[model samples]
Target chain A: MNEQLSMRQIVFMYLFISLSPVLRQIPTALADESGRSGYLSPFWSVFLILPLASIIILLIKSFPSLNLYEIMVHLIGKVFAKLIITLYLVWIIVFLTAKMNIYSLTLQFTLMPKTRSDFFMQIMLILVFYALLRGSKTIFRFSEFSLGPILLLIGILFACAITRLRTDYLLPVSTINLPSTIKASTSVIAVGGNMIIALFFADKLGISLTKKQVKKFWFGAIFFIIFSFVITVFTFGITGAGLTARLPFPFYITVKSISFFNIFERFEVIVTLICILSDFITICISFIILMKLIQWLFGLEQVWFCFLPLAIIVYYFSYFLSSTQFEFNFLYRYIIVNMNLLFQYIIPFLLGLICLLKRKYIKKQY
Target chain B: MIYIFGGLLLISFIKQKDVILNKKRNLVLFLLLSVCGIALGTVHMISPYIPSIAYSLEGILRTLLVNR
Candidate 1:
């Protein structure tokens, strides 16, 4: 098995992990905020996400050998770095629990409504344990391989739904709604900012990066924007903004309208499977990142000791965080998105500013 | 359910015994976190109907900000 993750692999991982949220959260959020013009929000998000992506690329290029933690230590001193990482540890724990809760809730609402959520969470914990035991490289590789087919399935669904598109549902955008579209882009920015996850694994990208690796990072960022835009457009175009806003899983419901030659009418099953797969990968990667944060914060030589305990805590806390879909939405929109913006963009922007100030010093060191 | 968690914790500790033995801090931290997990689980088992922190926060935020 491969041990180290390449920049390409990391990019694929970010793309893969963000798929779950892009599918589940962004469409509904956009629809809720901007109605028919919600599809345009993804484009407005580029104004924020593009700069943030550039900052990430700069940070990784400047400090090729260090992860986010070590980069923080170098840029802002050890004490502050540890303090920030400690805060990260807290945020990730909550984030991981939220991911778990959402995954379970998704399953409950879609697949097995009769089964208790704790059962789903328990099974998910076992799968995550097995994946982590195989090592982080396996998780990255799984994402690398899975992303292609997942995108292909989405593409196929979009093609099928093309016939169902109602232009009236998507058009008639007035200049008056432009402000609401910009406001709704917060949902897009919240999910897109997850690209910063690349930094957490930067140390694994090795010492020197080639131009090809940098190009891959840009490809990943652009691909993410296109993916979000296309998904939102399809959801709104087929399902309509009014229904999209009302439904919890707009994309899932949108997929139900797909009929491939009248033989495959139940394509919504594929949507559920895709969601389950996306959520699984997301939870595993988030768990790995959580462990990495703990390792960095506590200076642990082996993270396995705390692994089981942390999983147990996550399993229970998933229930504690949000028991129902309503609570989950409130937590996600009010708490998690804002928190993601802070940690993923604001803090990284701060680091980029520090890197700019110490450019010559950083260059001299390496 | 608690028994399952206990067994898993025991197995994890046994699997990492050598490393935890050498690094006493890891052992302490492991036990501390495990105890916390078990405590949370017991509380949850006792009353699963408890409104989550999100619920409270939503109520507070809605009243404080939205209601105003």
Candidate 2:
């Protein structure tokens, strides 16, 4: 029997991939773009991902048993499909390598002061390699199990920080500058490009996603991301949030700023550990999806063969790209987002359109 | 550092020995990937302070975006 993932597993998959950014530099990037109005960006971004997710689900449903890779090959020729997959693979690997490295760097800065960051990355990668030895299904199951405690702990932290949250931080909804707010929202929406990963396993999700299920899928994932981001933006407020621009991971900074009942202190350690877990989950899943894409690219039956080789490339690239956190910020903020739009949205939208037209032509002929 | 990677590759080769057996193409993909990884890793270890493509892209974006 083909490996089948439950709807919960599928939703959790979207949840982790899309929201992984909340742990790292994405929060400050949002704040730096628009001070007070930055909180609104997540809402705009979630709303943006909805229709795109719907289109992708519909596209997958139209081509029974075929994932995005297979659908691309069926619609376009194999050569063109492989070409597209090559470009898409480069985009994903470079983006994820930065995540792997910078999160390790953030560890060096926040959590592990004495240890080398690559050591952390290597250990994490070993765990990922073991988990992925079977294939892509392990990644989904890991997400299914790992997400519960992470959300619970993060929720407790947010609840504890409630008294510290300043709605005033989100103030003057009208005086909010329009242009920068839009720019910030676009950046946030760029993370929504992660909705495309759902397409990778759309055919294997086991259950057909109904319209309501699709709505729930996108909504649930966006909720975690937007909620965490809103809490962070409000916790830091307009003025205080500026401090996040300098911090490696702003969520930690927000958790540290919180004071619980004037008695408990240093809630940040637990929160940081939990976030590091979430970041690890994100990196693992990214590498897993990369493996799946490579299998499709080369028509290889045993993709596990290339796993170690690709891991080596990923580790090396992570080092090469880890020149500075500034590079991480620049890659995420400037280059990767635009690539997300082009590769994730615009190209797939066109492909779906062509598929629809071809289906209609075939119907008219019959 | 290079020695460390070489050792790691050897370990990976040993672990994948079964998969590597009678698979000429797979061997080629592994060798090519190892070469690419070693080349990049060596460059990074030697320089340790190169301006990445991200910086150049950021410069281009700053010119185009014209943050107002």
Candidate 3:
């Protein structure tokens, strides 16, 4: 693992991952859950992420100068560590396919209805495989350079599009049942918990992570999540809740609705650029993390061997994961969201607890 | 399809010939995962559907949802 990095690089990588391809669905899901005052969904979801991120931070601190996989192996037994790593392998496979399916669905609905989605998945995975082979440092470096410009474009677009939101729709927080609202906002876990992926490669970040830094990242993530929510709500809030629930890609539609001086109505390209850049980084970063975990599990010295095989598996599985939009949405709403909670929060919390309780004599077991 | 997977396996094996030939355990582990990938890929190519963790769980959940 390469070990030369600054705080800025780490922060930017987390920011990009925290705001991801799945963000487009959040507002609509929130609207469906919380009804008219759907905007609060981001708040609910991000709120849950703070504690989860904190747990992961503590879990990482427990094991000295180790990556997430090493931390797991130390805290838990080897067999359990393998089980968790295997689960993450399955988890990331679903993550890639979910994003691929959704991106494909987004394209089919918007730009290229005639093109096969499998084509896009294959191309995207191939590019990601190349980046994964190049390794995490290169991807994080690209993230550092891209973050400034992408954030600026996102800010400008948010300013232009948000002016169209009706204050009336944004006033109330939520009028629905509590359980439904929580359920709707579960996707926030996906974004906020993404920082935990960075911990998997923490040894490469050079500096030992601190509580203060984790707090800073949480604040930074909250700021980004708030910005994302505003756009999501404005897109759905001003357009009416029914339309938000109707459209799969309401944020894209919101960008389409933006028209400055009646000249620049088609500003969806900015949204597309942000989505594509983030998706590219996200898919590659995910594969890198998965490959690292596989290496740790199998005691393989060479990760290059596992890279092509796992990438091919991801590519093939992407084709068969979800055949229709309904299946995709159902999987996201029920299965993936719940699973995200289990792995992101429950598992990390367990590890953290074990770290606290275990005596000092429990030296490095691996 | 066989030839394509065969070519990938042979080429990767050739590239890492020293590591593959030197350690039998490493070779077994490498071949096991690679063959699994190839089998899944080939099945996906030939059939309309291939079994996956995502869809299997989806089916299980859907069944639960329908039953409930």
Best by lDDT: 1
**Candidate 3 lDDT score at position B21:** 70
> What are the per-residue Cα lDDT tens digits for candidate 1 across A46-148?
8988899889989988998789999999999999999999889888898989988998888888878999998999999899889988998988889899889
Itemize residue pairs with steric clashes in candidate 3.
Answer: none
Model 2: runs farther than 4 Å from truth? Answer: A210-215, A221-225, A361-366, B21-23, B56-68
Ranking by lDDT: 1, 2, 3
lDDT digits (tens) for residues A155-224 of candidate 3: 7766776668777766655454566666667776655667676568666654366666666767766766
- TM-scores of all models? 0.98, 0.89, 0.89
List the candidate numbers ranked by TM-score, top first. Answer: 1, 3, 2
Error of 1 at B53 (Å): 1.1
Worst 10 residues of 2 chain B by lDDT: B20-29
Off by over 4 Å in 3: A171-179, A210-212, A359-366, B1-6, B49-66
RMSD of candidate 2 to the truth, in angstroms, is 3.2
Task: Choose 1 or 3, whichever is better by lDDT.
Answer: 1
Q: Per model, how much of the real contact set is kept?
A: 0.90, 0.50, 0.40
Task: Sort the predicted structures by DockQ, highest score first.
Answer: 1, 2, 3
Candidate with best TM-score: 1
Q: Check candidate 2 and list the clashing pairs.
A: none
